[model samples]
Target: MPISNSSFAFLIISAFLFLSVFQTHGKVIINTNGIGQHSFADMKIDCGKECTRRCQLSSRQNLCRRACGTCCARCNCVPPGTSGNADVCPCYANMTTHGGRKKCP
Candidate 1:
């Protein structure tokens, strides 16, 4: 079967649109919630203190604080009382290390 130029262009455009939508699907799921409101409305963090405290047990203080800070900001929830309490925040707890271990400080 022979395809016309216009048909091929249409197919290309359709594929691009499909892929764009697929790539953004995850963001859409994360964004929508009750009343279309953000879940972190009252999110608060003492960045330096939280990071320092969370990373206290780690030998690599700088690395621990950096990664913990990122996870805290992204999850908008940090485990309470720190040190072996990551399970309190599912997202934080589920984060994986580069070597497939738990990464969140």
Candidate 2:
């Protein structure tokens, strides 16, 4: 038995449609976590003050300040007025370095 040209084209079209739907739809389904509810406009953050206060307790002042600054800017949050309160900002607290260490000071 031999396949006709129309039958071969139908199989190719079906495969292409199946792959396109799954690839695009899968990402939308996986990324629907509610993390995006907090918009930038709703964030009330003082980056400079937050970073300075958070880094003040560290012995590595310069490095601590740099890391704290980066985290504050991105997260728009610093834990509190002092160090060791990372629980206040879950996103900043959960960020990891390339080595799997905590990235923020």
- Per-candidate Cα lDDT values, in order, are 0.72, 0.73
lDDT of 1 by residue, 1-105 (tens): 999999999999999999887665433323332323233344366767888877777899999889888887877766776577755676777778789998787
Please report, as a residue range, the 10-residue window in candidate 2 with the lowest summed lDDT. Answer: 28-37
> Can you write out model 2's per-residue Cα lDDT over 1-105, one digit (the tens) per residue?
999999999999999999887665443221124344233444357877777777787788788888888887877778776667776676788788999999987
Counted clashes in each candidate structure: 0, 0
Residue pairs whose backbone atoms clash in candidate 1: none
Q: Model 2: residues >4 Å from true position, as ranges?
A: 1-44
The candidate scoring highest on lDDT is: 2
